[model samples]
Target: MALTLVTGGTGHLGRDIVDRLVRAGSRVRVLARTPGVRSNVEWAAGDLAAGAGLQDALHDVDTVIHAATFSPIARRGGIRPIDFFRSPSAVDVEGTERLLACAEKAGVRHFLHVSIVGLDEATLPYARVKLAGERLVRASALSWSIVRAMPFYYLLDRLLAGLSWLPVWPVPTTRFDPVDTSDVADHVVTCAFDGQRGVRTEIGGPEALDLVAFARQYQDARRLHRRILPIDLSETKARGMGFVASQGVRGHLTWTDWLRRNSPEA
Candidate 1:
């Protein structure tokens, strides 16, 4: 059946998007390497990197809410300095092109892409890969919308969790405005149905805080005590890479609120 196809449906943000779509009563399909068990949702087994199952996944689909990105560096705990230079050309780059082509062939009406902010200002290889994917979407023949969002609180939460054994919190500090995944999903669904095109203003949480502040709040919420030894990040305003949206609208949830709701210490 024709539906609103969501790429990366198994992911954190993609899962929320799919759930919201299903709850909103839009016929929904999800693209994943393994099929999902969500009721009323059709899961198409597909790998973006390999270009398999895209035709069947996109077939007769009129809208696409894409939240997929490839970053093995992230998957491996983001500690490798060398892996930072690696580009997601195969998945985000080539796979984006493949998806767009197949979607056009299926006569998809709107293609919504999810991206992080500061891709233009950041020199990171991951940013470049995401930019390349955005380019493919913009240049595609199908109608398109790109939603740039701030870093999620889960990112810092995970990073801190991985480093919880450290004696001191020695970390690079930078400005960040983390958003909730559900808020991003809501905005994505709204944009998907609004029928507008082109890149919209970035979206983030209510307040902007640096990495040190975020860490402190996290430690407090998790009932951990560690002295912060911060390294100053200079030269670029985009210190957290794409984590801060330069000028953007704010979502309702704040980092503290997210912590209060999700953290076990709460």
Candidate 2:
């Protein structure tokens, strides 16, 4: 059996992928900056930005699932736009290139990457970096699969949490198709083991909802009494995110379903 190496194994999506792969009886290795022991997986201490400990992690690994990212959302506050974009560029773009080089040298057979839907048309710095990373994966010599997923439910939860204190939730004219991270992990793991080559898959949630409606649903689920105020978005911003909202293969869970299961009241 070929050993599968997963990057960002501690992240929301990556951790699920690691668990699914383990359950499926595949040998799994995780690459992280601070590696630790899992029940049935190997870990290597590595940082994509510094290119450290990667070779050791990749050794004897036939499949590489690149799930690591320096999330723009996590680093957005108090940073210049240029710096915001640069941070992910260093990880998503340059780190991908570095990983690809090492994977090729390691003679890895398959590479799977997780990305967001419609990033090619998005103007966000995060989207731009993800698209660049996708391009790098596509250009690689090894057999590769790229799965572009909808925004995760946790992202919506974070947005709602930020606005929970406000009497009125101010939502933009944008829309989203937020899917469960576990569903995305299922697709990613399927692609990893299916022996498919050069495939790009796009996955989304069961329903598309405008920001206000989405927030309203979230508020209801949380048993909160708050008015949803629609804020007009600039055409460029709306168009970019609109493209993201409009694309992908629908997953099993709707936002409401996700909320019912994950919300505090549940």
Candidate 3:
């Protein structure tokens, strides 16, 4: 069997993708910078940033799902003003260039690149960086598909958890369309099997909710009594922070349903 090689297989979306692929009986291999815990699938010791071990990982792989991404600022919690001016990080750009090059040499049949939904919001560094990876895939000689997924639910859940102990939850007047990670995972797996080329149907949540209402629903779901304070996000929105597609292939899971599933108290 021509194995399917997945990059970032241990990451948030990558983990879910790997699970679905394995369940579907596809031979799976994951490229990881370090050792991974999951013993079910084959793990290729590699570093995308260093462009090492890719040749070995891509060997005999017919499908490639490029999900690995890097952003130090986001990892550290929040982005600073100066972060915008600095050049975007390396993994998505240099790593992807190298990955595509190696995949071509290894005769990859299909290259599916996982990307965020808001490339039009390229004013933001993260979106810009994602675009870079997308460009590399499109320009590559291999058959390629890009799945543009909306922000994951975990992002919002983490934001709210930070203020769970506070008396008031200060949320922006801005709006967003976030999808459950598992739902997005379903879309990715479906696309991989469908084997289409070019950018696929953009996916997002069922409804785009206002931040205040979103947080209120969250606080209520969590059985908390914090006052929901709505603050203006005009500046942030102007910078394209609210860049998720207002509409897309809507996910079946609503934010409320997702909260209940993820939070024990909810």
Candidate 4:
């Protein structure tokens, strides 16, 4: 049995990948901020920024799934744009370099990096950092796979939650194909076990919809009636997101289907 180390194992997608790997009978270890024991899974306390506890975590690990990230939205309230870039760069770019060095040293065979779909087209700081991380993975000597997935349904749910209180929801004109994290996880896990290497695959949800339509569907699912106000995005931003809307390996779950199954009862 091959040993796999999953970074950001506590995150939504990372956790799902861990679950899938465990169910598939693979030996799995996770690098977390606070490590502890879990059934069929080992944990190592580590901070990607500080490069601590990685040695123990990477020990005997044949493959690494680099799922750790510092998202900009998580710091929306108190963070500046430069700070936003700095934060993700620290983890996504610099931290990835640190991890790559250690993985190389440990003689890890395969590295599966989870990235965002249309990242190359995106201008956002987070996206840029993620793209940088991808480059690092590609440049590394180890065999690798880069999976670029669309925004997760859970992330959309959080967006809906943040805007649900408004009688009128202001939505950006940019389009999105929000995929389910579980579906993305399945792909990630599949790539982890598969022998294919040095491949870049993109995945997205079944349907492409603008933010207004997404908001309407979200409201209908929650049994809430709200007016949706379309906010015009800059042409550059729209074009970039439009590019994301155009390509990818589509997932099984549509936005409506995902909401129907996952949304709270009315």
Model 4, position 81, has a per-residue lDDT of 50
lDDT of 1 by residue, 42-81 (tens): 8899999999999999888989998988776556655567
Candidate 4 residue 41 C-alpha distance from true site, Å? 0.4
Per-residue error at 107 for model 2, in Å?
0.2
In candidate 2, how many Å is residue 113 off? 1.2
- Kindly report which residue pairs in candidate 1 clash with one another: none
Candidate 2 or 1, higher TM-score: 1
Q: Clashing residue pairs in candidate 4, if any? A: none
lDDT of 2 at 211: 79
Tens-place lDDT digits, model 3, residues 133-229: 8888889999999898888887778778778888977777766788887888899889987857888998998888777888988888888899988
lDDT per model vs. reference: 0.83, 0.82, 0.83, 0.82
- For the record, the alpha-carbon RMSD of candidate 4 to the native fold, in angstroms, is 2.5
Candidate 1: regions farther than 4 A off: 235-240
Using all chains and alpha carbons, the TM-scores for the candidates as numbered come to 0.94, 0.91, 0.90, 0.91
**Which prediction has more favorable lDDT, 1 or 4?**
1
Measured with C-alpha atoms, the lDDT of residue 92 in candidate 1 is 88
Model 1 lDDT, residue 114, Cα: 96
In candidate 2, stretches whose alpha carbon ends up further than 4 angstroms from where it belongs are: 75-87, 234-236
